[model samples]
Target: MAKEKKYESELLITRIFSAPRELVWKAWTEPERVMRWWGPKYFTSPICKIDFRVGGSYHFCMQSPEGEDFWSTGVYLEIIPLEKIVCTDSFADENGNVVPATYYDMEEDFPLELELTITFEDHNGNTKMVLQHIGIPEGITQELTKQGWNESFDKLAEILE
Candidate 1:
């Protein structure tokens, strides 16, 4: 008998939005819509470009309250319209070139590439979205990522309203 492999994931976040699943999906895949709510509180995405197909990429800059800019880029690995999205996310420059997590000068080691999977399901007339992020290193705390997601989702909800 073959032994089963237990897959370990670092973070999981779930949000139930008061909107249709398709609308929620649009908010994630459309650049115009994403600009409205892609960052956390006090952070604005001044630049966003999304080519939302398999192997396509999305890049954006999240501006801090103090006017500092941080960039993130992702390449889509799978996309199921209105249902699921899987992508590899990484810190990057304005040109979308990969950057090491050490650039952030954090104490812990944050993985340069992290796989994020999101699924959208219909909850009656609303939408239930689940986001799972894998490959976070042990030295890095999950709270930081969780807080960022929670804050970003709060912004997303406002746009969905």
Candidate 2:
């Protein structure tokens, strides 16, 4: 029997956007701007509610091209103005209660909640952001999540341009 390869439990991505750090921070904190680029390619964020402060919560609804809605809710754990944000992320119902990924018909191994840390820095008049998502499932789901984030970043870049 072939042994399964162990994978890291976290996903990390770093990208530089051709915008100021403050602009990138606003893009994340403002509901209207987040609605513009919160999901993968072809996925639209039709509803976004943000309470951007420590201990506050946010809810977002991403609709697929086929009209399936994916809801996510998270509570802010830490917030550093124009610099960093740490939150707890999870699948959620329209009412913003946390749910297991299986609630969305996804893999059972997906954690009920995940930690997300994002840090922003100024890079030659641009913004360099680092994203750390912990507790992603240790297999294909992680890859898919990374791809989704990349696609969303692509959309964000286009909007910034």
Candidate 3:
């Protein structure tokens, strides 16, 4: 039997957008705007189902440029309109069943889900967005996951632009 791995970490990413807070908030709360820039540059989210309320569920499918598909689902734990959202994010099947999410090619020990909290603050005409990703695997794999997230965020900036 393989030894079980114990790993934990958290990631914080902050960005300032030159847009009104309400518009920036809408880009995240609205499914259509979300789908436009939710994944990496080479990936596109063709399907997104969102319910903007606490206890609601959101499901989406990201298609890679090469035709590969990945599904993600989450349950909203808390929601403050145009302010903050807290949820659990996880990999899922096409039917929205939670499954193991392979991070950085790690075949074991990675958490099946992550608790994410996102906040949007209005700073004059700029929107300050903060994303907190908790439950990250430790060691070198954490770096890879971080990189992936940065890339995804870059895509989001483009979508918002």
Candidate 4:
């Protein structure tokens, strides 16, 4: 009998924004604010539906510059105002039904479900935000995901300024 190998990885990114912790928190909890910086550069979030409470869920649609739409949905597992948020993340369809990453033609090794933890701290009147994403497969996909996240954060920084 052959044993199956298990594969799992995580991505961690920390950034300091020149904005108050409350403001940064709102950027995540408020649908309108989220639309301003949800995707990478030149990507517009056409839809953002957020129910900001534990056990609540959010659905978002990020449209690429070339008109491709990528949808994602997540359920809030925990929430602490101006402090932290823990959620279950997953790829989804336009209607917000949970789907595998391969549904979008991504690598087959991508996990069907993922976890995300976001923490915010006060840093000299600014906000220090840390994002921990779990269950991603390591390699090019992870690198691309990191680039996308950094681009999204850059957009968030511009708005905070």
Which candidate number maximizes lDDT?
Answer: 2
Per-residue lDDT for 51-90 in model 3, tens only?
A: 8789989998888898878888899999988899999888
User: What are the lDDT scores of the predictions, listed in order?
Assistant: 0.84, 0.91, 0.80, 0.90
Candidate 4 C-alpha lDDT tens digits along 115-158: 88999999988899999988767889889889999999999999
Candidate RMSDs in Å, in order, are: 4.0, 4.2, 3.5, 2.8
Candidate 2's C-alpha runs over 4 A off are 1-8
User: How do all the candidates rank in terms of TM-score, highest first?
Assistant: 4, 2, 1, 3
What tens digits encode model 1's per-residue C-alpha lDDT throughout 50-133? 988899999988898999888999899999888999998888988899897666665435667788899999997899999998
Cα TM-score per model: 0.90, 0.94, 0.87, 0.94
Q: lDDT value for candidate 2? A: 0.91
- By summed lDDT, the worst window of 10 consecutive residues in model 3 runs over 1-10
Question: Can you list the residue pairs that collide in candidate 1?
Answer: none
So what's the TM-score on candidate 2? 0.94
Q: For model 4, which pairs clash?
A: none
Q: On residues 60-157, what C-alpha lDDT tens digit does candidate 2 reach at each position?
A: 99999999999999999999999999998989999999887888899876777788999999998899999998878767898999999999999999
Badly placed stretches (over 4 Å) of model 3 are: 1-7, 102-106
Give the count of colliding residue pairs in each prediction. Answer: 0, 0, 0, 0
